[model samples]
Target chain A: MRIVRTVADLRAALAGARAGRIGFVPTMGALHEGHLSLLRAARAENETIVLSIFVNPTQFDEAADLTAYPRTEDRDVELAASAGVDVVFAPDASEMYPAGFATTVSVSGRIAETLEGAHRGRAHFDGVATVVVKLLLAVLPDTAYFGAKDAQQVVVVRRAVADLGIAAKIAVRPTSRDDDGLARSSRNARLSPDERRRAAAIPRALGAIRDAAAAGETDAAALRARGLDVLAGAGIDPEYLAVVDPDTLEPMQVVDRRALVAVAARAGPTRLIDNVEIDPETGR
Target chain B: MRIVRTVADLRAALAGARAGRIGFVPTMGALHEGHLSLLRAARAENETIVLSIFVNPTQFDEAADLTAYPRTEDRDVELAASAGVDVVFAPDASEMYPAGFATTVSVSGRIAETLEGAHRGRAHFDGVATVVVKLLLAVLPDTAYFGAKDAQQVVVVRRAVADLGIAAKIAVRPTSRDDDGLARSSRNARLSPDERRRAAAIPRALGAIRDAAAAGETDAAALRARGLDVLAGAGIDPEYLAVVDPDTLEPMQVVDRRALVAVAARAGPTRLIDNVEIDPETGR
Candidate 1:
């Protein structure tokens, strides 16, 4: 595996592999099993696997969060290589954005106006859409892998690609989770020992709500209350817990159709989020 | 030259070409000498040349402008073939932009805020940047040619390509002008014979100011007044005549640095615009 730090260098490497099927997985460094899962999936599908590790500053709303985000360049390269990534591109912000950079990509409504969009500050998704467009253009991959852990992000990216006529197949990988049912996240490492232990309840709370919704508990308000109560019982500061349509991302009064039971909470200094689907027919 | 309308057809035709070099010229139909000059330049520089005549509706602010825009597809194909163009793509709006399109590209501040940018209505350049990006991606040309007659348009496009990190060399062809000094434009056809004759003076006025600047005229206000007065003397409704920095597009008060002597006017019912550079030291 080659560790490339410049867009030009990465392009040079990709040029030779143009005829081969390429799969891209873009990530901020501090790779965990979740990111490695995306890479391994890309490796399985594409003849040429390219992973980019750039901690995009534009996506972070809080300065302290941006500064505190983990960086593990050396370990990330080794992990990606072991996961069968063909190339690891680790570009600095300056390389991605030189002087006189002025262009931005934005979507007006719906996709950028709910759930995470509401919580994430202004221009957050604009930055995401712009950087993703840039990376997709640079890589020119046949398929790109993104985990469903960031569910809203996947929807926004898919919408951007489709609306803008960008040619790429986006494969949304299932969210990777730890043995305790906690979602595998880079931020998971930031959780203290007690916080990690308590984080298991986050997913467990979402599971209970999904079970209730499947059992014909059609009241959205009740479902939200139950989920929030679970997080509160776990001594977590519940940010938001809601029942929403999975595809459209609109709030739902009941699980009459496909719905997502999503939750977000602050467990100590680490903010954790998790979700589960409610199967209306199965009542599971 | 083969006229390809669909993206698939264009891709196939481009793929079949020899792997020497490819030059592309994207234009709105009703080709004049200026567009032909670009085609000629492309033919001279590359082993294969592809031209796209897409009068993108998204770029037009006025319905009348779009309606009045010429559509001479058959003649355009013949002219392109004569100019040795390998392929000509003339896609309908539906073929390029389908329903449910939501993404847009916007450049901030100066480049998107001057001359044509200020004159054209909202989302015009967004449409241009988006469509241009799409075309550049689809054609994958080694070199792309654009005329400098639309000076601000050139800067906006150049900034977009650089900001998006698109890997294509952009060549700005010098503006084509008539003997009487009117710049060549498809809209010039909208003018009556007398209006067209009067339009010639638009460029003539700028040339006189350029000559004055060459003779060591330093005050930008004086240069602008001279250009505007010349146009007014010709009975043209001089919209604006100014000496300004070429790159920044900011109004200049002194001609110690590089400047552009540009003019826009209403010749009867038709609007005509023209410009010339003032290089104080070289005295062109």
Candidate 2:
């Protein structure tokens, strides 16, 4: 895979592949199996696969979260090449956002006020939406891929692209998980061995609720209660456990249609999130 | 100029042009000498010149203002063609902003907060920034031209483009004025015969401030007072008269450096704005 470190370099590379379908996966560095899965999916469907590894600082609400985000450039480059990636754009913060960058993209009401958005501090989604739109513009991809791990983010970004009249198809790939069902995440690197062991309980708790709902539960409130009990049993500190409509991310009751049972919890200092769909009548 | 109403038609026309420098000017349909000057400037600098005539509804805060906004499509097309513009895009509101469109581009806490933005109510500049950015993206022009009559808008938009990391170079063309010093504008169409005569005071007011500053009027308050007197003498309803930093649009005292003298007023029911640069030491 070719490695590009500046916007100019990426633009030059992209110019050569103008007519073909370019599948793009934008990322923050510290690639894991999950990111590789996204890349592999892109390579399968596109004539040219372009992956960007930019740890956008604007999206981080906490300064410490920005600093704590892992960096593994040398390892990432090797993994990308091994995965048959055509190009990897790893831009420094300065290149992506110069000294005086000022324009921001914001979606009001619906996407910016539910689930994860409701709990997160101000402008977090705005930062995410703005950076993603910029990346999409820079790439001009025929198809852009986002992981379902950030399902709400995918919906919000899709809305942004559609609302802006950007001519790019968006795909939300399923969340990659481990043997214990834990959702793969870059922040997983922050967990100590003991914390990692406990973190598995997050997915396990979600799985328990999914299995219960799959069996018969239809009441969203009752399902939420079951999920909360599982989290408490696992000794996890729950931030929020919600059953919401998958499309709007607004909390819903009596899951008679497509819905998501999502959860966020802190196991030690590392925060983890996981969710599963509650199928129509069975709620699974 | 060829009048193209659809996005596809506009794109196809632009595609046939040589991949050389293209200059763009976006405007509402009513063409005046001011808009003609911008087209002329673009023709001089660019390999191909393109103009868009879309009366953007999003920018109008008041429905009555929108209804009263003038549109002279036939004259505009003829004027553009005579000025040597290669293509003109005149899209309907529905085509530009289809159903479900909901994204916005924002330049926060910058100079967009005062002057025209404050007087026009919230979401006015938001709409302007969003539409301008979208148009820039669609055309991908080498340079975009805007009139300096909207001095606050010029500064705010420049800031927006810079902040968004948009590469298109923005050039602020000189404000085109009439024989009596009234700024050229599409809204001038709404001015009654008497109101049109009175509207000349807006520019005269600006000119007086410029003259005062050039004559070494160091006090900002005194400069505003004199400028307001000029508007009052012409029987124009003065909304605001102030001296501000040319670049930041921030209110300034003592025009020791390059400053702008800006005014806004109502002649009958039509609001008019005008501005000029001042050199306090010279009082020119």
Candidate 3:
């Protein structure tokens, strides 16, 4: 696979492939099962597959978190190559945001202003939207792959892409998870042995909400309480356990049709989030 | 020229032209000599020319101004055809911004927060940046043309295009002017006969500053005072008379190199703006 480090270089590499279908996967460097899943999905679909590894600094709400975020470039490139990635774009912060970079792409309203937005502050999504737009423009892919692990992020990006009329399709694959149901994430590497065990409660809590919703519990507050109980029993206090509309991310009072139950919590020094979509008629 | 009203149709029309150079000119209807000049420039250089006429409502800070803005589609189509435009994309507000649209493209820092930004509020530039991004993406032109009459706007749009990594070159044509040296603008039609005559003072004010700079006057404050004197002589009170860096839009204490002298004033009920770039060594 060819690895490029500049936007101009990335564009030049993709110029010849414009006539063919191009599938893109944008990720932060430390590749996990979730990222690999996206790459594999992209590989199966397009004539050219481009993988971008940029741990965008603007998206990090805390400096400590940004510093702690892993950067295993060599391993990431190997995994991307294994997944049949044709090109790997690894640009530094300076290349992505050079001197006098002052533009921001933002998606306002509930999709952006709640859940992650409430906890991480608006800058998080603004940063994500900005970098994603830049990457999409840089790649001009026919379709971009994203894992559903960052569910809220998928919604925000979809909103930004649609609102801006970006000519790229966003395809989301299901979240990749471990045997114990802990969502696979690069941050999972930071979890301690005991903390890792406790992190399983997050998925369990989401599962509980799904089970209850499937069994005809329509009240959103009741569904939230059921999940809160599961987390509390596992000795984990969630930052937020919300029952919301899958699209708008607005808090839903009743799960009349479909609802998303999402949870975020601190496991030792690491923060982890998990979510699941549930239907009242049937549980998947 | 064939006029298309939707983004899908616009894209379909320009799909075959992707092999050749596409030059785009984005404007608010009621075409004048200034817009015609940009079209002419595009005609001379590009194989296909796309003109978009959208009076974006989001860019207007005041409802009255938006209501008062001109919309002459028949005349605009005739003028665009005369100027050799191949296709005209004229999407209405609803077409451009359908239901649940929530994205905003903004340029921060001095370039976006001062002068016109301060007078019209930050929403003005935010709206402009957002719509311009949408329009640029829709046309995907090889080069986009803009007039230098709206100097600060040119700066803002340039900043946004560069920051976003948009795949288009911004070509700025010199400001088109009337026989009386007044910058040609669609808004000029709203001016009364007396106000139309008074509007010429705006350009004269910029000329005074340019002339003073050419004569080795380096002090920005002194240069601004010269422009103010000219405006005062015409019995006009300017909203702002600024000598600033052409790129950053920051007030320049000393014009050691390149500087932009810009002025905005009320000519009766109509508000008009004018600017001129000056170099101390050899000012045009």
Candidate 4:
């Protein structure tokens, strides 16, 4: 496997492989099972797999959160190699955004401005959107893999790609989970043993809403209460417990169609989010 | 040349040409000497040339201006073919922006929000930046040609391309002009015979600034006054006449280095803008 740090080197590395399919997985450098899953998917689908490990500073609303974000470069490189990544693009902040860089890619309206946008600030998605555009352009991947854990981010990215006519296809894989049903996240590693157990409540809370919605509880208020009950039992008060349309992220009073039950809360010093999609018709 | 109205068709058209260098020139339809000059430069350097004629609605601040914007498709195709364009990607509004289009590409700071941005509103550059991104992605050209007539726009495009890590190299061709020293523009067709004569003074005013700067004039106010005097002689009251940094578009109090004297005014019912770049050392 080859590791290239500059955009020019990345392009040069992929120059001869243009005729074949290129699959990409973009992530911050803490290689967990979730990230490896994306890399594994990319490995199976394409002639070349490119993994980008850049902790995009723009996406972080708080400097402390950014500083605290994990950076396991050596471990990540080993994991990427094992996952069959042909090339790893690890660019520093200055290399990715030189001096005088000022462009922003934004997806406006509810898809981007609600839920996570509300909690993280609008700059969160704008940062995500901008960095994604840069990564997609740099990689020119035929298909890019994204986990369903960041559901709103997936929606925002899909909107930005379609609206801007980006050539790559976005493939959303199911959210990776732990044996305890906790959704896998790099931040999960930062949790202490007690915090890890508490983090499990987030997914359990979402699971309660999913189970309720599947059992024909269509009223959003009632569904939200069920999820809140689960969180309350674990002594957790969520930042938000929303029953929203899966696509638009707009709150739905009645879940007549597909809906997403998402929850966010602090587990010790780490902030984590988890979600599950529920359909009124099929319940699963 | 082959004309592809859909992005899919455009990609299909350019698929085989990817092995060779592709140059792109994006413009709004009513072709003129300015657009053709860009095409000619593209023809000389690239193995294949793609020309896009899209009068993007998002850029227009006034509905009346958008309505009055001339579109001569048949003539444009002929002019493109004569200028050696290989493929013309002419997408309709619906093709470029389908119903749910919501992404905007913006270059923040004075580079985008001042001068033309100030007069036309921020949405104008947002629109320009957005459509240009869509077009560039659609073409995936090695180099994209932009006319230097829209100087600030060139700066915006260059900034957007760099910030986004877009692979295309931006080439700015010199502003094409007429025998009367008027900058060639698609909007020039809207000028009446009397309005056309009055429009000539716009360029003359800029020329005065350029000439004065060459003769060691450094004070921006004096340079602006010299240009304004030329407009006054023609009985035209400009909407804006200021000296600004060529790259940043920030108002300059003194012209110590390269400066741009830009002016905008109404020629009868038509709004026109013209500018000339000046260097204190070698102002020609």
Which model scores highest in TM-score? Answer: 3
Please give the CA lDDT of all the candidate structures. 0.83, 0.82, 0.92, 0.91
Candidate 2 at residue A265, lDDT?
Answer: 85
- Fnat for each predicted structure, in order: 0.75, 0.56, 0.95, 0.97
Question: What's the ranking of the predictions by TM-score, best on top?
Answer: 3, 4, 1, 2
lDDT of 1 by residue, A228-279 (tens): 7777787876777878777678888867777877777877877777777777
Each prediction's TM-score versus the true structure: 0.93, 0.90, 0.98, 0.97
Q: Over 4 Å off in model 1, which ranges? A: A235-238, A279-284
TM-score of chain B of each: 0.95, 0.96, 0.98, 0.98
A1-284 per-residue lDDT for model 2 (tens digits): 78988767888898888878899989997999889898889988999988889888877877887899999989988898888888898877787777656678987766676766777654878888898888887788999988888887887898888767677889878899988778999998898877888888788777777877788777887877777777777687688888888877777877778887778888786667777776866444
- By summed lDDT, the worst window of 10 consecutive residues in model 4 chain B runs over B275-284
- TM-score for the first chain in candidate 4 comes to 0.98
Colliding residue pairs in candidate 1: A214-A283
Candidate 4 per-residue lDDT over residues B1-284, each given as its tens digit:
89999999999999899989999999998999899889989999999999999999999999999999998999999999999999999999999989988899998999888888988999999999999989999999999999888888999998998889888999998888899999999999999999999999999999888888888889999988998899998889999997988887889998998888788899998998888888877757
Q: Is candidate 2 or candidate 4 better by DockQ?
A: 4
Regions of model 2 farther than 4 Å from truth = A1-5, A281-284, B1-9, B18-20, B74-87, B213-219, B279-284
**TM-score of model 4 (CA atoms):** 0.97
Candidate 1 vs 4: which has more DockQ: 4
Error of 1 at B43 (Å): 1.4
Query: First chain TM-score in every candidate?
Result: 0.96, 0.96, 0.98, 0.98
